[model samples]
Structure formats: C-alpha cells, structure tokens
Target: MYTLILVLGICAAALFLAGFARGLRNAVIEYRRGKPEPTEVPDYNYVGMAAISVVISATVIALVGVAPMWIYAGPLMVLGTAAGIGVAFFVERPSA
Candidate 1:
C-alpha cells in the first residue's frame, strides 16, 4: 500500500510538471503571436494540478507516519497548490 502511494505520488508529480510545461508553452506561443493576453488553462489542467496536490499531500503523510491523512493533508495540499499556482502566474506575468 505504501509503495503504491509512492508510485502514485511520483506519477502525479510528473503530470503536474508536464501540465506546467504545456501551459507555459502555450503562453509563450500566444505572446509571440502578439496576443493581448495568454489563454486560461482548461479544466484538464486543473485536474492535473489537483492530482499533484493530492499526491504531495499523501507523500507527506506517509513520510511523517500520520493518521487521518485526509484531515491535514487535504487542506495543506490545497493551500500549497494555490500558493504555487499564484507564484507561477505572478512570475510569468508581463512586467509593467
């Protein structure tokens, strides 16, 4: 069970990275095309991001030997992912 969790965590991380890369690529393409703004990511991107959050949360719980994994892990993952997404957007935004 633990091994399965770890494997899932790794896959989730990979998927997050891939989605991030894809979003970035599309943003760049739009910029190069002189579009006024980058396109919003689709629902699938959010799903991928959510998967990553859950995976990270699960990994943290497993590493710390915590019980009731959902209690702490879920909120932490949500907060962490939100902050991460904000940072990504801020960094990628056009400078005034």
Candidate 2:
C-alpha cells in the first residue's frame, strides 16, 4: 500500500512537471508568433488544480496512515493553504 502510494505520488509529480512544461512551450510559441504580450498570467482554473492537489494529498495520507499523520498533516495543511493563497494572489494581481 505504501509503495503504491509512493508510485502514485511520483506519477502525479511527473504529470505536474509535464503540464508546466507544456504551458511554457505554449507561451513561448505565442511569443514567437508576435502575439500581443499576455497581460495576465492566464486563467489557471484554480478549482481544477486544487481538486487534484487535494486528491493527491488525501491518497498520500491514507496510505501513510495515522502514526505519521500527526507529523505530516499539520505541515501539509499549512503549507498547502499558504500555496493556495499565494497562487490566488498572483492570479488576481494585475500584471505590471
């Protein structure tokens, strides 16, 4: 069970990296085509991102079980909450 969770976590991380790469490629292509500079970060669909993150964390915690929960849950929740807020701030902030 733990091994499965680890593998899933790795897969999730890989997918996230691939997505970031794809977004970077798209932005580069747009820039190369002389498109008007994007005035914003683009709509990130935070609901989708949040859902995935929650699922990943939940899966991890379920696999890790209760003993480590005390150690992991607090930090994960705090950091995840902070990251969510940070993303929102960036998304909402006007582009300079």
Candidate 3:
C-alpha cells in the first residue's frame, strides 16, 4: 500500500522533471537564436546562487513533510513544473 504509493509518487516526479528539462532546452534554444553571442564572460555569484537553491530545497522539504504524501504530491509537483516552464519564457532578448 504505502510502497505502491511511494513508487507512484517517484514516477510522477520523474515525469514532471523530464517535462521541465524539455521546456528548459527549448527556452534556451529560442533565447540563443534571438541574441548575439556574448563577447565577454558574464559575472555571476555562483556560491550565492547555490546557497539560495539549498535554502529553497530545505524549505520545500520541511513543508512537504508535514502533509500526507497522497494529498500534496500531485498538486505541488504539477504547480512546480508549470511554474518552471513559465519562468523559462521570461529570458527575453533585448529589442533591436
């Protein structure tokens, strides 16, 4: 019973992740097509970005742990995937 539910949850998460990856790839391709290749390396705070990601992951885990898996897994995964796909579109190229 519990084992079956866990398996289903894992499968659903995998499918959502695959969709997100596909959307991300398409978004990157579209973005590149609209912009020229950069002449200079972009400055980014890699450590800060990683730390923020870790904090968000930890917060999500804590919130999800409070709910029954069956109640939270489906909607949260769907919403998360949708949000990720939507955000991919915001990487706009500057107008000419």
Best by lDDT: 3
Off by over 4 Å in 2: 1-5, 38-68, 74-96
Instruction: Please provide, for model 3 over 1-96, each residue's C-alpha lDDT reduced to its tens digit, 9 standing for 90 to 100.
Output: 557656765766665667666667766776778865567767877998899978876776787768766455545555565555545444444333
lDDT of 1 at 70: 50
Question: What tens digits encode model 2's per-residue C-alpha lDDT throughout 1-96?
Answer: 456545655655555556555556666666677746565556666998899989977877776675765555544455445444444443442322
CA lDDT of each prediction against the hidden true structure: 0.61, 0.58, 0.62
**Where does candidate 1 stray beyond 4 Å?**
38-96
Superposed Cα deviation of residue 65, candidate 3 (Å): 3.3
How do the candidates rank by TM-score, highest first? 3, 1, 2
Candidates sorted on lDDT, descending: 3, 1, 2
Clashing pairs in 1: none
Worst 10 residues of 2 by lDDT: 87-96
TM-score of each: 0.40, 0.39, 0.41
What does candidate 3 score on TM? Answer: 0.41
Better of 1 and 2 by TM-score: 1
